[model samples]
Target chain A: MTIKEKSEAIVEEFAIFDDWMDKYAHLIELGKELPIIDEKYKDESHLISGCQSRVWLHADYVNDNVVYTADSDAVITKGIISLLIRVMSDANPSEIYSSDFTFIDDIGLSTHLSPTRANGLVSMVKQMKLYAKALYLRAEK
Target chain B: MGFKINSIRNDFPVLSTKVNGKQLVYLDNGATTHKPMQVIDRISNYYMTENSNVHRASYNLSHIATDLFENSRKFIANFINAASYREIIFTKGTTESVNLVASGFSDIITEGDEIIITVMEHHSNFVPWQQLCKKNKATLRFLSVLKDGTIDLSELLAMINSKTKLISITHISNVLGTINPVKKISEIAHNNGVPVFVDGAQAIAHANVDVSEIDCDFYCFSGHKAYGPMGIGVLYGKEEWLNRLSPYQYGGEMISSVNFKSTTFNELPYKFEAGTPNVAGALGLERSLRYIQDIGLDNIFKYEDDLLQYATKKFENIKGVMIIGNAKSKIPVISLNIEGLHPYDIGILLDQMGIAIRTGNHCAQPLMEALELPGTLRVSMALYNTKEEIDLFADALMKAIDMLT
Candidate 1:
């Protein structure tokens, strides 16, 4: 499925929970299932600074698609990163770059997020797209 | 010393607010405080009844506004025990208050002079001096925090020498909640012939601040921290210092007369206040100070002291709950990091459970770096907060830890 479709799927799933408590529970569940990043990639070089929570993101280029791995010390931050990964992992670099993260707004996650968390979310998205852009440039070369 | 908790809670309307289907347990008083209905009503009343430009017109409305504005200055002067109301200059907040001093001191600080501040100072208190020192080609010396988060007073005294121009320090640290000995340090600074500036942003609200008692040359505090309005802060300087230093800003309200070639500035407080003052904010802050006076700071101090001890004991029983600041003398703010768990995660989960706590550096990056902590979860208390709320916060924190692990 396309990244947009996968994002839509997330929005649809989120729409099922009316209460914030239930929605957070859903997020916690998602956080629990986030794939563990390799120990080697969890170094300071891959770390995303300026986040209240410590988040590490690492990318690998497989064939023509860019794959991403990330982890955060915080559960909600981990859930947020996992959501982005679910939508954009194994996707083309151009597709990742063009993505606007409207899915977060559509799922009402942006509004629900605390100001600090929202900032962290923005940084996470930027880092992911940056990785994609780097890979895209390498592929073009 | 009778202090009623329930009625005190009732004064703050936001205390009754429910978040995520649970009663809000706000423990983030260090960031800012919840305004009482008295302060809110005073602000509304000022706009509704006395909305006039102060010190501009001889009209009745303007007269009333000017009276209210000057009365606030007097109230704050009396509150902090300044020698005179003329010594109190109104600024935006503590940050601006510190900036005003830093700007005024810039001319006096020559090359190779030193400005000393503690590592635990808020960025507002730290950054201005840093910039001022850099601009003046002076050195900025930082007093290190002890293991218990208190400043080493002996070490601080040893560092002070002939080159030291000014010594600025926080009365109470925002992150660690360590209450520094201002009076003692002021004496030491005076002995060294250096002026002292006390950043009372965290200290003013939690306890009584008497400039006379402390004998500090400069003491500054924000109104919002003391359950008052934002955009109105009090900067109390000794009349001697106020007369000597130049005005920080030049504008309408600050000038006595202006000409094509030369303009003479207004005297004392007026010289410092630049533009048309925040009359509404000043009145609201006056009422807020009156509110605190009505409740009494000593009573508030005693009540919060008991609450802090209770909360500390409760957290002590929790596994892996490592508190960063265990100062011998401190306020109610508790900054902690749980083992194998991040503060951000705890803050998020606590927030979800209708508990409000500040998580991160709390703007004291130097102190955080010194302590080797990425960040911390800070739970600061106010007079309105109760033991029951702390119980709820502790319970929610335990539940959050369970979920995260």
Candidate 2:
């Protein structure tokens, strides 16, 4: 599925939960199912700063697509990271790079993307896009 | 003069608010405190009627502003029981106050001179001295904390010598809430011929601080942390030290006379305070201090201690909850970590329940490294907080843990 399709699906999934607690519970469940990055990539080189919780993100370019893997020490941050990875991963570099990821706001988790939140979700998204942009530029060259 | 919790709660307008459909339980007093109605009104009144550039104009408004501003210095000097108002040099806040002193010392500290600071100091206190030592080619030594988050006096005594030029310590640890023996430390430092600078940012509101009694060369605290306005802090120095140290900044108000070639500096307090000061902030701060005085620090201390004990007992029974900093002497601050859950997760969940707390290193990264933990959730209470609020927080914490687990 395309990034938009996956994000919409997740939004729909989240829409079923009327209460904030249920929404958080769903996020927690999703956090457990995150595509774990290799332990080797979980070092300082892969670490994303500006977060209260430690987040490490790794990206791989394969089959003309970018695949993302990430982890966070905080489960709520991890949950947010899981959603971001699910939305942006397995897409071409240009597609991942250009997407604004407005679904975060649509799903009422926009606060996580705010710089003040400092949960690394904002940094994670930025890093993901930067990686995709770098790959896209290299491919153009 | 009675400790009326309800009336005191009413004094703070923000306490009546709600967050996320629940009553707001503000427990992050360590970060900054909400201003009482009196402090708020004081600032508003200053801006409305007494708005003028102090120490400059000859107008009536300016005179009123100047008197209010100068009176704030005197009030603060008296509040901390300093020798005179000249000892009270107003700066931006505690961080700026520390920086001002550190900047002055940078010139005096020579090669091989040492500065001792505890590992539990906030970044504001830790960074300035570290940079000062580095720039002057001096040594920076850290006094390690014991298991219960208290420092051993023997270790401090052993660390000081002829080479030790200064010892900057916090009156209370922001993260651990351990109240250090500032008086004892000051005595030790003075005996060793080393000046002591106490960072009273955390202690100023929670306890009564007398700079003269402590006999520390320098003591500093932020106004906002103590029920006052932001952007105004006090740097209390001995008259001799204030005279000896050079100005931190050079500008309009801090100068006696200025020429194209050279400039002569102003007297104590004014020398450190350059440019147009935060006159309104100072007035607000003075009013807040007065409010505290009327309430009485002893009464405030007793009430907070009861809240701390009540909260501690509740958290002690919770499974997998580890309370950090079990120091015998502490204010109403508690830092805790769950067995497997992260502090950020707990903090976010608690916020949803309208319970505000501080998470992460609390700006004491070295302390976190020493403790071998990432960070912990901290709940710092104040005069406005109550046992009922603590009970609510404890319940929310358990629910958050259950959900996360």
Highest TM-score: give the candidate number. Answer: 2
- Which ten-residue region of model 2 chain A has the weakest summed lDDT? A112-121
What is the per-residue lDDT of model 2 for residues B267-379, given as tens digits with 9 covering 90 to 100?
A: 98799999999998999999999999999999999999999999999999999999999999999999998999998888888888899999889999999999998999999
Docking class of 1: medium
Worst-scoring 10-residue span by lDDT in model 1 chain B: B340-349
Instruction: Provide the RMSD of all predictions against the true structure, rounded to 1 decimal.
Output: 1.8, 1.5
The candidates' DockQ values read 0.64, 0.66
How far residue B21's Cα lies from its native spot in candidate 2, in Å, is 1.8
TM-score, one value per model: 0.96, 0.97
lDDT against the true structure, per candidate, is: 0.90, 0.91
Candidate 1 lDDT over B186-214, as tens digits, reads 99999889999999999888976999999
**TM-score between candidate 1 and the true structure:** 0.96
Q: Specify the highest-lDDT model's number.
A: 2
Which lDDT tens digits does candidate 1 get at residues A76-132?
788888899999899999999998888998988877678877887888899999999
Q: Which stretches of candidate 1 lie over 4 Å from their true place?
A: A12-26, A29-33, A36-45
Assess candidate 1 and give its lDDT.
Answer: 0.90
